[model samples]
Target: MLHCPRKTARTLVYSGIFLATGLAQAFALDPTGDWRVADGVANIRVAECNGSMWGAVAWEKQPGGRDTHNPDVSKQNRPTLGMPILIDMRKKPGVDQWEGQVYNAKDGQFYSSTIKPLSPDQMEIQGCVLGFLCGGETWTRVAGPIPSSPANSMAKGPPKSPGAPPHTAGMTAPKTTGSVGPKTPGQKLATAAHPADPVGDICLLPDIAGFAH
Candidate 1:
């Protein structure tokens, strides 16, 4: 048997702990769930679709709002209820943040944006207009912490991290997960009178489907 020094053993232990801490910081935060926006007018539901993240309006204080400001005339008449606000957010390696485009319905423009989960219940959102950085806003969690699925249904919900946001409303990414089981009859069936599950429904929404992958 070889002799091992006590001091060397202790040093090794400390090194292991430090490495573990660093690795934890490197992985992205799971930003899934319903999150109340800074203005408190609506909640955005966020979830993972394919491989990236997407967020859309889930609830609004004043229903029947329209995306009348959309630059695309054909889309202007669309309702804002389930409209995607955070478009195509992907994880930023080595940090707990996601980078993408955020829609400003007020102006019908998309801005460069980044979302960071400050804590389990809070998130920070910052966007830029024509490369000029704008002010950031904080969002509070409201729902979700659900799961991410191929369809983003509860059946395929993603695993929740003690992180993420700007969601539970729309930036709550990863939205909330487990090994998805076989599909059930209740999964995708929908009609105008009874809509599909909003959490994962955005995955199939026409507005973003063309670009979801």
Candidate 2:
């Protein structure tokens, strides 16, 4: 029997996985790409940032839509395109579904939500208001399965110093709703008539960069 160090053995296992799958991005929430909403009105870009999952509006067929219904008067003029629709979704332990909050721009409400991938190109998003009036829709994958970003990463940074405390969130995450998001902090939000920049990495957006754990 050949003897191998623990680290070496782990590397061998991961190498085997890469060799077998061509890539190891098949992990459940690897749904980090663009998805077309059921209504076909918009595309949401989902990605994992800071160990949690989040999504934002990447495109809107109608182009100029506002969060007019948003209770936050400050954000009422912000464009719906490129807005963060999915908030702080953390994976449920031992389950494939993720639990978090979803912003319903139509009603300007924050509803409890869960997201699960049904297939390589399909994902299910369920949203509920106050635990009732539950409803869901299947979104068709349009772009990703892409690589995660490092901006708000938890494990990709420099090694912690000896005896250093573990990384912790310096500030609480933005409120589930009534907080400006999907918009870069400090930068003036665009009007509803603004066009979407579907190609951009939303994880770099202010709300996301500041919220990651």
Candidate 3:
């Protein structure tokens, strides 16, 4: 069979590009898991929402916290436990970063955020507002099964407090909330020994009526 050299070269180039794109997609970092944040005082569950990614406060050191600092007067009364703090993160093409907005309940402000996975068990999370000033934390993956239901989580109650008894089934705790600041020198990111697992429905949060845009 007669063959054209120029056509063969073009075909080879196209094949290479196709393979490269496929490889990038195949090895993309999957951030669908529970991550320990705020110096291990809080656990935020990252999951897929509406083709994008979002994170919600799955568990806090203190339960029954409210979004007292939220700028919106009405939303201030909302509980922070299930609040969607990491909002609408879209994966950046050909990279291990995701760009989105991060809402800080402590300051009641939304900042531009980017999440980059440094390893399967660790990721760098950054939030910036003034363009130049940026703060970040290295979040480590949390292992084991996350509470499957609100009832189950409440049953387990907040992490044990010295001299405090476990909360009753129906009783709620006092609200206590704090801000997540930049990691300081010598600050260690929390780590877990269990293997990473898909968050599944355990971390899914209710859809915010108008949050997605």
The candidate that wins on TM-score is: 2
TM-score of 3: 0.59
Give all candidates' CA lDDT scores.
0.67, 0.68, 0.60
- TM-scores vs. true structure, each candidate: 0.66, 0.67, 0.59
TM-score of candidate 1 to 2 decimals: 0.66
How high is the lDDT of residue 30 in model 1?
53
After superposing candidate 1, which stretches have Cα over 4 Å from the reference?
Answer: 1-28, 150-200
Cα RMSD of predicted structure 1 = 9.2
lDDT of 1: 0.67
Residue-level lDDT of model 1, residues 171-198, one tens digit each, is 3233222222222232222123235334
lDDT, model 2: 0.68
TM-score of 2: 0.67
- Single out the weakest 10-residue window by summed lDDT for candidate 2: 174-183
Per-residue CA lDDT of model 3 for 36-135, tens digit only, reads 8848877777654434567887667777889999878988888887688788888898787889999988799999999987775677899999676899
By TM-score rank, best first, the candidates go 2, 1, 3
Clashes of 3: 0
